[model samples]
Target: MSELENTFNFSELEDDGLDIAAIFGDTGTAEPLPIPEPEPADAPEDTGESAPEAERSQKQPAPEVEKKDAQADGETDLFAALAAGPKEAAKPARNDQKATGQVSLFDKPPIFSYGGAKDAIEDTSMTFEELRIAKADDFPELAEGKKVSWTVEYGKTTKVIADPKGTTIASIKEEIEKSRAFLDALKKAKEKDRNPDCLVKPKVTAQSKGIAGYKGVFSTVEEAKRSDKTICLIPARDGRVYEFRKTEMGDFIAPKDNVIEFSAVRAGFTPALPLIPRDLMGQIISFFRCFMNEWEEFEALAHIYWDKEQEEYTVFIPRQRVSKARIDADLRGSALPEERYIHYADIHSHNSMAAKFSHTDDQDEKATRLYFVVGHLERFYPSITARMSCGGKYHEIDPSLVLEGIGEEFPADWLEQVERCESRSDTLLRKKDFLHAFAALGDMPEESRL
Candidate 1:
């Protein structure tokens, strides 16, 4: 034995199933075996004792660990694997989509990458006058009037160019790119000018969703009335489309009149601005009664204008011909600048009658304005009703929406002043004292009736 072999017992390592001679020999000709990995318990928990002490302690090997020919066979198996040639990787299972040729739909030319050729197409069925043209400097590659190929990517116009590499668009200068983007937007807008696809179409849902789909939209009322869609939408001229609906009584494209649904539980009118002052409302009522007659009714017209600078409302009485039944006013408006004093409401008196909108009032109040009617002028407490009219349609609104409201505030101490007795007014403001004296007209003397 050599001095190195004699230095320590290698028989202990061989007992652990490792061949000492085979592993240390030169690997120039024969392939070296891969050493088998040790299992748990071969190197037990650390103890202060040495290897010889551990053998004396009688430590047991784990179950299923055959510390014999199993290691020898595993070592041979690893060497045999290295000596053999590499096997091909397993092919993935086919999904059988090739039979239907659907794979071609996902296939693309190796060079085209941004998107498919489908993105290059645009519906040019309707075209307006050329809104924009590529500037000469921005597009030096494009000829003035010759046909050119271009597409909008993320809304920016990009021109196809040939390159030494795969197909790609040439990089534009920063300034030129911005200019092209502006022109691209204009071009797209012009394309959608009269296109039906670009026009908003009303959608049908389980429940009514306002005008988005309830009415067919159009550029004009005339267009809406002539539309073939079941419902239509017309631009409200305020960036939103007007809701025009089809009615069974024939005006399919009629201007929709919204109702201020009166609810006993919920608030019907939520005020958007301050109410008209009580002093101004009193002036309107007193002036309206000036032309009141017991036998005949006279309708007087006046416009309520708002001065934004002063933030107060002023009445503008137009020159008119007044009679027992009607008043014809020259409503061409005065020399007032509309920019400052906006005519917000048109109010008229129904004299001694109940507050209501008449046919003549509806016909004349076609312009968009708030309309008011002062009725029961002969009574101590007159009635005033308010409504809004727009595009020849009317919407009844709570009079308190704009008016300062009825009744005056009494002194807070007046509540304590209420004694046992309270005197009632005999002015017959509401139903009159006739109910107490007489049930019907025949119950009263002929001379006692008005």
Candidate 2:
């Protein structure tokens, strides 16, 4: 028997048929190791400096023990590998199961709580009392019998009223009394009803056509004849004409009222005296005399101004700047300085002819200013005529009224003086000449007249 076999109990092992040699890696059917080649002649001698090769060969694994040690080591490595395999993997599942169990047990999500200087507790078995409990250090020190009172009151409100300026208690009371009185009066007024007939207007009309504020249409002859509104035209039934309205009685006779006779009333404008100072009137006369003497032309023109600020009438001898004719005349001057004074009157001469307003004169004196025509210059006392074209009418004013404070060279009654100075009546002579001229023309045929 081998010494190794003698050292261990082999009888029981042999009866069990257990291969002990196999466990120890002693395979009976083993192959021998290769032998080394013999050294050549004349080979180099060994100095024995290196260790023996036998010892190297001895340190190498014996084939019989290699498999045995490998088997034992592999078993141990397998068990250890299993133990080290993904420790984090198994731990997470266990932790998740524990977390889920805790959530389900508490009927709420697992919450982590932190408290002052304490380790975290993840156990689900914690009770509400344990969570609510506080450490001794967390409470504050207090007196044994501290008292407190809290009150809540209801059913009351506060309001702020703004006081008006200049208001007193007496004024406020008076206003309240006035308001009550007004209300009482209004209530009493509502008790009485208004009459519908009282609210209606009366349908009344005036009797006289001349009276205004009446409800009818008719010719107001008396009122029109009395009024200052001059009527230019008056028609007749039998084609007869009358130029004037004569006063027969209290009521007046108009131009068309009397159709039987051919009569004439006031033909031209009625005159109104303008307000002129005595001194200014004299100056105006002197200005005309001087102006006529200066210019011996058939006709001459001049402008006179009334300065309201200075209260004086001044004459302006403007440059003629026109081609004058023997019988008729046209004149132009610079723009009158109306800003300084009113351009009140315009005067011109007719050089020994009759004092009359011409068609050109009508156009020239269109504005509201007094106009004068001086004629009968051959005689010592010349004829003077004054008029104003205002509100669309030639209003003849008395020459005496306009030239009030003049020297006695002019006549007081100029119209009478003009008649007496003439050799014969001009109107009769003109009528005689017109009849002779018509007689010479002979009677026209009826169709020719039409």
Candidate 3:
């Protein structure tokens, strides 16, 4: 403190010779004061307007000022920033996230496995009649009153049983075995004597023949001519063929050669020889009768005629076979018997129209046409009546060809009209042109149309 006072006294003495010690606090008692240096004459004045030289020197350049001004004004210097700005740090990339839950790659759901899915099991507890009754209850329409037989399978042994009295389940099983054996034997015998190209015999009775038998049905005298292969020669009974061609009422002349006849009856006729059990025979007869009745209903709805005595539902189509050989050839690949005439009643059940029936050479295009025709008919006549009355199995006539025939026979514009009436698309055909086309097909046509 004494040194500090002495120094301060000296400094004050040098400055102005004033009483410095009295004006200043004691050095030991108070902190030393900071004295500002006296202003020099050479020092620049600060009027609060001009910035210091050093500060001016450190300020941003004119270009930088302009750039800052531009940025503040929302103007970006993309290129300049790219050249001058600090480079961005590169970021690390990440891989795709995987599913979290535990999963089994090859695990499969459990499925039931049966030891014998289709193999019939033997139940010695029940008799044959009980089994038949059970089966009949299951398929009452097809099996009721129908003789049923059974074959019981025990390990590797099979035992046949007959149910003549329809009494017990055990008897039914025995009959089933007998029936199966009989059928197998018959099948083997037929195979041994089978003829690959043999023609099928017709089913006709003598009572159903002759001009007197077909009296009012024949349109022309020639149609009445009975042939062994023909059912009945009748003119267009329903006038469908006459009307379809747009022919005049009187222009349709009855065809002399147009004959309808069934093939010969099967040779064996005895009740037992037929091999069909009485109960089964009743069922078969009922089934056929129902089929025929339904078929007639269908025909009547379509305005087509069904001649019961003739056993034919005649509808006009463009083509007919000249010989049995031709018919066989046409039906070579068919599932139906080659020589047998397929009844309209059984046609839907057999799904014959939906089947492909063309020869191998034609690329099976006829199947598509057949499907179209069936679909068309189904659409128009959705009812059972439509199915029966639509008539004819594979009329075998091309629609386009029929159109051409109609064009040539009627007014030139008629063909165009027919074309316009054809279905635009199969889906639409069901509701639109189906019934019209079906009715048109049934209409009578001029002779020249064929």
lDDT digits (tens) for residues 243-358 of candidate 3: 11113342233334323332344322111111112343223223323323323311111111234455443321212232211221233343333243322222111111222233
Q: Candidate 2: global Cα-lDDT?
A: 0.44
Candidate 3 lowest-lDDT run of ten? 88-97
Best by lDDT: 1
What is the RMSD, in Å, between candidate 1 and the native fold over all Cα? 25.3
Who wins the TM-score comparison?
1
**TM-scores, all models, native as reference:** 0.35, 0.30, 0.16
| Cα error of candidate 2 at position 78, Å | 99
Instruction: Kindly report which residue stretches of model 2 are placed more than 4 angstroms away from their true locations once superposed.
Output: 1-296, 321-333, 405-450
List lDDT for all candidates, in order: 0.51, 0.44, 0.29
Which residue window of length 10 is worst by lDDT in model 2? 194-203
lDDT of 1 by residue, 1-450 (tens): 432332334445446553322222212233234545665455557777798988866665532334333333322232232223111000010123233322211111111112221221122221111101322244333333233333323223343322212322222211222353432353344333211111111111223333443335468878877777656656566544355566777654434454222112432345555777889878877887778665666778887888889987888888888875678887574636888887788888888888888888888888877889888888898888888876777888988768775678888998888776433553443347656545677677889777
For model 2, residues 121-191, the per-residue Cα lDDT tens digits are: 23324432232232223422211112111111111111111232222322222232234342233223322
Better of 2 and 3 by lDDT: 2
Clash statistics: count for each candidate: 11, 1, 46
